[model samples]
Target: MPEPIPSFAALGSHPLHPMLIHFPVAALLGLVASDLGYVLSGDPFWARAGLWLAGVGAFGGWLASGLGLIDLIAVRRIRCLMTAWCHAVLAMMMLSLASLNWLQRYLAAEPILPWGLYLSLLTALLILLTAWLGSRLVYEHAVGVEAKE
Candidate 1:
């Protein structure tokens, strides 16, 4: 008989969906924090870092989402589909926003557009909600984690 395939659970939560997620989480959070800094202090540098962090987070978000999706699929759960969909949509949104933000900045080396402030805020909120859904999907629904009794 063939050897049984290895399971992600063996590696633990960090690598599963929680680990490797800090980049995007930190990026998005940093975007908001830095944006606030910019607003409070009017420091162009902080604003720049915030925008760059959004771009960085978007890239990491894409990878994390991909990993989450893959694990979601491999584990196979109804809630996972819903959770994945939520995360996927928001992730795409975040990625697009970050891309647009970076493109605009690259073209002009400027701070994020004024409206972008609101958009990033919304994106961060959605990402946070998506993260919650992901937790529900795994911890509550046993989607990506091992099947429970």
Candidate 2:
């Protein structure tokens, strides 16, 4: 009569996964801006945050995507299944790259700035595509047509 407990990876991929996702997104973006400021305005704080934010965001994004995939697989509907699959496919790549970039940032510190920027830019593009389709699933299909509901 009781429901089975969900896995951590599944929990990471939930619809509301974005809620937990924003932190790293903002942090990463802010980091980019911070570095840009350092380059243009000579203020180092922004640049420092950029380095710090990348690692933090990488962790958050990694966690959120992990849980999200779990929920996506549990869905029985095809549309949601496919859309979630697409998101998972792209996100997996971004997460891996971002994680690597973050690790590189940690090791090389300021000198590795470009790595984080490039990774974030790529991840941002993928997230934009995934987000657009995901919005369609939620708005048109109503909770993603992939669900049994």
Using lDDT as the measure, the top candidate is 1
Instruction: State the displacement of the C-alpha of residue 144, model 2, in Å, after optimal TM-score superposition.
Output: 6.4
Name the top TM-score candidate.
1
Off by over 4 Å in 2: 1-15, 78-80, 144-149
Span of 10 residues, lowest total lDDT, candidate 1: 1-10
Per-residue alpha-carbon lDDT of candidate 1 for residues 21-51, written as tens digits (9 for 90 to 100): 7788888777888878877888789867876
Decoy 2 TM-score against native: 0.72
> What are the lDDT scores of the predictions, listed in order?
0.65, 0.62
lDDT of 2 at 76: 52
> Per-residue CA lDDT of candidate 2, range 1-149, in tens?
12222233333434456556677667656656665676677666765666677778789888877656655666455223465567677777767776776777667756335665676677667667766765654555454222432
TM-scores, one per candidate: 0.74, 0.72
Give residue 9's error in model 2 in angstroms: 9.7
Q: What is the Cα-based TM-score of model 1? A: 0.74
The weakest ten consecutive residues by lDDT in model 2 span 1-10
